[model samples]
Target: MKQMTRRKWLRGMFAGGGVTLLAACGGQPSGETTEEAPAADDTAADAPGVVEETGSAVTVTYWGSFSGDLGEAEQAMVDAFNESQDEVVLNYEFQGSYEETAQTFAAALRADTIPDVVLLSDVWWFNFYLANAITALDDLAADAGINFADYQPVLLNEGVRQDTHYWIPFARSTPLFYYNKDIWSTAGLPDRAPETWEEFMEWTPQLIDGDRLAFAHPNSASYVAWLFQGVVWQFGGQYSTPEFGMTMLNENTVRAGQFYGDTTNTMEWAMLSADLNQDFIGGSVASMMASTGGLAGIQESAQFEVGVGFLPQEANFG
Candidate 1:
């Protein structure tokens, strides 16, 4: 494996139409492999700059979980790649949600029919690495002229383990505090996001309307833990050491938990929602914490003026 930049890696992965498949086959060859070429159509021959060669174009399957507008965007990218080159043809497959994609990949591993490429979640990619199910892209990236230094340190560091790079950040995001500015103004509260958990709590009472919740907590298994990490951090607690050797179980953790529990169970200020974005957009909740990746869609669908801010901090910890 050799050093490369993240920008070039992304270009090679998408625009350049180059991806090496390393299936999870024990003791089997794990390198670049291509699939049989599909029959070319009139569109292929008509594509600009594409010359019909004697040999069939190399094909590779890519599994991803994007749907809706994101799915459409991904398809457009595949189409552009296929039209740009006559040497390679990309086969795009929609494999459902991230969890479902993992399940399908696991089954494919057992059947020895894994896709050539996959889009994995940040939380789940490490498990695949531990299972020896993915490949190190360092050499391949270097060959593609990737400049690793161009990538943000925190995002690039997520894929490294014991000095080996097994994954690359895609669709990376941080939790953002999203709120309805109209609701805030109507409640006689400041027309801005609260800077701390205490300030947010103080605003909760005014934010509530009849049956509407001041805040909505995500209850889905995939999101609950991710959002809780921010709360735990704000309370001055570490989830676990990077080495995965030890985790803290102190007052900070307890305090964070109690604060959340009180929001719904005692203060009645918040309620759990399976879809926080929808709830906020529908005016059922005043504010909530969600991934920044959803901001575009939320803004497009929302009827009210939407406001975004950094996640509220704890008094001393932040």
Candidate 2:
């Protein structure tokens, strides 16, 4: 992407943090995507007899994980910024996904070649903070006269550490339910997704049968944690302590575990081993809990009618 002033970009990010999606305490995508356009183009220098101070050109390197069309779109925005003015030259580089970008960043930090700006996923915010590798941009904002309140509190909460802000929120994502509408209707059910947890359970058995599962794709610590969050919250429980130094697997977690175990083992309406994309596309599963980022890709790939709904809510208290 075009080179933007590091301080200036930080200020913009501070004010526009909501544009980026934070990691939904759950991993399912909630149909969120990057919504903000590229940062405003720098004004032309020497316009209308305004004397432009010519100075040494500076190079600002940016690293991100946006591949395919996403990468192309990102580059287009960067190129616009780069060509907007004759001041700083912004250099854009793609380093794969968040994990790959972070790995490259780690190497740069070790070699003292860290870029002028970097895009970080929400989960890594604390890691960078704890490692003391990220630069705080609070005073940078103050100098630029940007208001911080324009951003979402969640973004600020994740970005700020030790009274300073380092990374700016760039892309945000959330998790939601994806269902097969045709299958539901063919199964003699309404052409609608379930709303309450009771309704979901009441429909799963009827919607699924031999050789097909209602749900799939569990077993990862990340996804497991995501699924557990909904149930744990429904049962008034927490996964860890406030300090995040302790795990809190109370009765709620136990109950949640039993519920899931029954679904995959006893009920057989779900698979414990199938990848979500494959099973979802192959029509092997009726519903899936996935990230919002996958929607476009799935839509392009799915052969059957797809529908979306909010995750079901439990009807009864624990």
Candidate 3:
């Protein structure tokens, strides 16, 4: 395996966190006791994560895709890490959305001005991996004495390719059905989310009023694909095989697409939205599907009670 050097220790720290990285540095046996130390030398000075070698802390530039409430929280983590130790100083820069961040990263790669660490979404990391633009973390993590078994297998495995780990899961989440409880009560419907999209749509008419829509559809540019993937599966279809054989034209997939089109075009229940989050939080849209990670921001911003539940099912549940 290729060694992860130059940026190895820092990468390991980023993959893991500051606390875990530093803790792993003390590899003394459980029963071992401290002994009198010898005088410091060049080898001791050259050790990983030591500032004495360069007479100052190493500064690492990190590019991330987050803003607003999530952005504030991201900065908090960086501040905590910076304050936690003096060996490494994290310099964070907020890039825009995932798409924008990926675009900027591509440009940076071409210009050779990339930051020391760039946060890549799961969907974006594979492209970079195929282009050989990023390094493998297994070696760096191993050198740091990280225990892979300590991580949740499902999440830990997402970054593994051909048995080699690359992109670690950070802020990972899934789409959830979010609704305005106030609207539900006003509509005279059940207090909880419907068991199925069809069931939900049955009462959608009650939700559609003057300026209030029963639901909203984000455009393709706003990550509708991620949400739609679950919808496609719920309709008893698969977008593609594991090996990448697309099945968009498959009967079930087409049915799922038609269902979406009818909501905005035929049924006229849901309208296309530029900012669905704002719409839902502002009470203009009664319901929408969004990431679970949005829970905190929504709770903080919305004045009304927000109810969440599993996405409605259809021919099958995803």
Candidate 4:
């Protein structure tokens, strides 16, 4: 087995609000291999456009895909870091959406002009490892004396592949059950979110307004699979084995699919929507399962008081 490297690079970048790339380091873990060439040494010391000596501060570039208030927060962090230290200068850039950032990074990799630090999505970072587009941080972690065990086990494990850690949980999030408190009150339902699918189904009638949906199913390909995973687990089924090399097509999975179909197709309580959050905020939907990252935005946008809760589970499973 190949030894995995601790995600020290992530720790350093996150702490400093900047990142540095070490291109000469490369290693293959498990069955994967890559022949990618090293990126040119373009650190602040050698980069042409930057001043080599800014009061002896080391400049680092960070690329991210944050916008709106989130973008402002990131800029604020950069400002704080710059103000606190004279040894490091952090330059932050908003690189559009995650997909666009990935595309730009791929192009940069081919040209050997990649940014010192770039944000990669949870689903996409594994591909970067396969391509050897990034470096391991075992040595760096040891040099910095980072304690990997201090991080949350679940969140930290997401970064570990075959033992190697390639990504860290930054801006990590999960689906939340967001409900309109005013709508719930009008419906005469309980003040809290439903605890089970059956309970939610029971409350649907009261939640409905003439043409409004009680809930909206996420329709985008990106969200459907993620949300569906919760359903599959709730039904006591595994979508795939732990290794993800084989899929399971058992009765539980079938039942889970049937439940989703019933909600959207048969019962008419919920409809598939490309914009569930918008509908929920606009009063077209009484409730939705959405990213917790949007909680603040939803609170600011909604006219009614918002209530958040965990995703409802199957009664039997709960």
The number of the candidate with the highest lDDT is 3
TM-score of 1: 0.79
The alpha-carbon deviation from the true structure for residue 253 of candidate 3, after best TM-score superposition, in angstroms, is 2.4
Q: Alpha-carbon error at 269 in model 2, in Å?
A: 1.9
**lDDT tens string, model 3, 148-206?**
77666776676676687765666677778999999899889999988998798899989
Q: Model 1: per-residue lDDT, tens digit, 1-318? A: 122232234334433332233221011111212221222232211112111233555455778777778789889988877786665666789987666666787666655666657886665554555456565677656767765676677777767777766666665677888999999889888777799988888888899889998999887553666777778888987666665554557678778888889999999999998767778899999999888778898999999899998888894433
Candidates sorted by lDDT, best first: 3, 1, 4, 2
TM-score of each: 0.79, 0.76, 0.77, 0.78
Model 2 Cα lDDT, one tens digit per residue, 157-257: 65655565664556555567788887888877777667766677888878787888787755563355555565666655666653455446677666766
Q: Report the Cα lDDT for candidate 2.
A: 0.59
What local distance difference test score does each model get? 0.67, 0.59, 0.68, 0.65
C-alpha positional error of residue 67 in candidate 3 after TM-score superposition, expressed in Å: 1.8
Q: Model 3: runs farther than 4 Å from truth?
A: 1-53
Q: How far does residue 280 in candidate 1 sit from its true spot (Å)?
A: 1.5
lDDT of 4 by residue, 179-294 (tens): 99999998888888889998899999998888888998777443565667777888887676634554567888888889899998899999887676788898898998877777
Query: In model 1, where is the ten-residue run with the lowest total lDDT?
Result: 23-32
Spell out the clash pairs found in candidate 4.
Answer: none
Worst-scoring 10-residue span by lDDT in model 4: 23-32
